[model samples]
Target: CNALNASCSDCLGNSKCMYCYTDNTCKLYPSGKIIPPSSYCALDKARWGTCLVNFEALLISMGVIGGVLLLTITGCCIYCCYCRKGKNKRYEREDAKFESQRMERKARQEERRNERRSRLDEIRMKYGLMKEDSAPYTRFDA
Candidate 1:
């Protein structure tokens, strides 16, 4: 890909070649390294994949995109946690309300039972049907 007169499009035709805007020269892409070292070609001058953008711009764009994506994911996680905490608090409040209502109902039911028992006992005593606690044994006489 050392064609000095070849256009960037012509150099990019080969997958293993990169074009440099500094010298307008086509050179073989360095597959061993991640990015072409400054020795090979300046970052701003190096073009890979397409001739529309330089390597420096590509790196910056990719970095920005990755950072934004990371921040978005982090923000979503935080929001979810906050919502879940609020949900738990709501459930606790509802449970406490329900328990208080249950207690009130239970107390009313107990009061009604006590009142009914007392009325029955009073009627038994008035009719002389209730047994005396002092007298363990008693004979029935007509």
Candidate 2:
């Protein structure tokens, strides 16, 4: 109900939009001119400014920054993947080294068991408890 006339009547050919005042008057933007319905609103002509270029520059700068951030995130993701792969390879190498160490320990234990068996056989031969070239005796045999 507060809408005013928004028509321009001046040499600049600018039109005024009705504002929320319900006064039936047109006021020019950027100019403090109040034009009644009977007179032309020439005094309220808007002055053209260079704000469009500034807005365009701001938009382009934001786009460039956004693109740079996207590329940086992508690069970081790739680097992290490479680092994770390297860590996995390192872990596999360590696991293989541990397995080899376990196998060596088992081999050493088997060698020690063979040495004890040979010593026992020599003792059996000396005591005349074993036949020549026979298998080693268990505890039940003695």
Candidate 3:
């Protein structure tokens, strides 16, 4: 990796390399490690993959991004649970209102039925169609 020493961009173009400004050298990245140790190259001066960002800025940006994503997921879960609880309460209220309306309609229908029955009985008595007690059966004129 040290052979590609023309510039930082040329040095980091290779996947397995890091560039350091302190010594103006490009070194092979240590295998099996995500980031180079600060001892090898100071975080602020180390450039990898892109010359536009330093190692320190990359670490900070990645950490901030990951933290924000975690918080957003947690907030969404809490909001969903809270809204579900309120929805259940609203459903219960709707059911109760429907039951009350049904009861009122039932009572009104029963009262109307009773009133019609009484009116019919009064008409029957006025026309003498309802027989009195101790009456005898007899043939009537057409």
Candidate 4:
């Protein structure tokens, strides 16, 4: 007896339909009120359900995006650490090589100094500059 679109012809001839408000999707109401019944309530309930699904999808998408960002940052850190380790090892090897070269040069210089000291002692002994019983050498006067 209500307007033709107000109710589905298949469900029932009774035009009184339920109203939907989120939690309360269906509550009985008489026909011909300002609010349309059966079909309208069902349509509103379907719309609300669709909105909820879309909101859930949005949250899931944000989580995936955040996870990607976290993984990218972690990967960059690992790469930097690996590169830095290589640089430090190279520097240490170079330092060790330089130190060994310096040590060899120092040993050669020490040998030359010892030879000079022995020559000076021999010259002093031949010239009788030092007494035989005296210590082999003393500091030069000048």
> lDDT per model, in order?
0.91, 0.54, 0.91, 0.58
Number of the candidate with higher TM-score, 3 or 4? 3
Give the per-residue lDDT of model 1 (tens digit) for 38-121.
Answer: 988999999988899999999999999999999999999998999888999999999999999999999999999999999999
For TM-score, candidate 1 versus 2, the one ahead is 1
lDDT, residue 76, candidate 2: 96
Q: Clashes in candidate 1: how many?
A: 0
- Which candidate leads the pack in TM-score? 3
Candidate 2 — what's its lDDT? 0.54
Better structure of 1 and 2 per lDDT: 1
Off by over 4 Å in 4: 1-64, 134-142
Model 3 C-alpha RMSD vs. true structure (Å) is 5.3
Report how far residue 142 has shifted in candidate 3, in Å: 21
Assess candidate 3 and give its lDDT: 0.91
Clashes of each: 0, 2, 0, 0
Worst 10 residues of 1 by lDDT: 3-12
What is residue 18's positional error in candidate 2, in angstroms?
A: 18
User: What TM-score would you give candidate 3 relative to the actual structure?
Assistant: 0.78
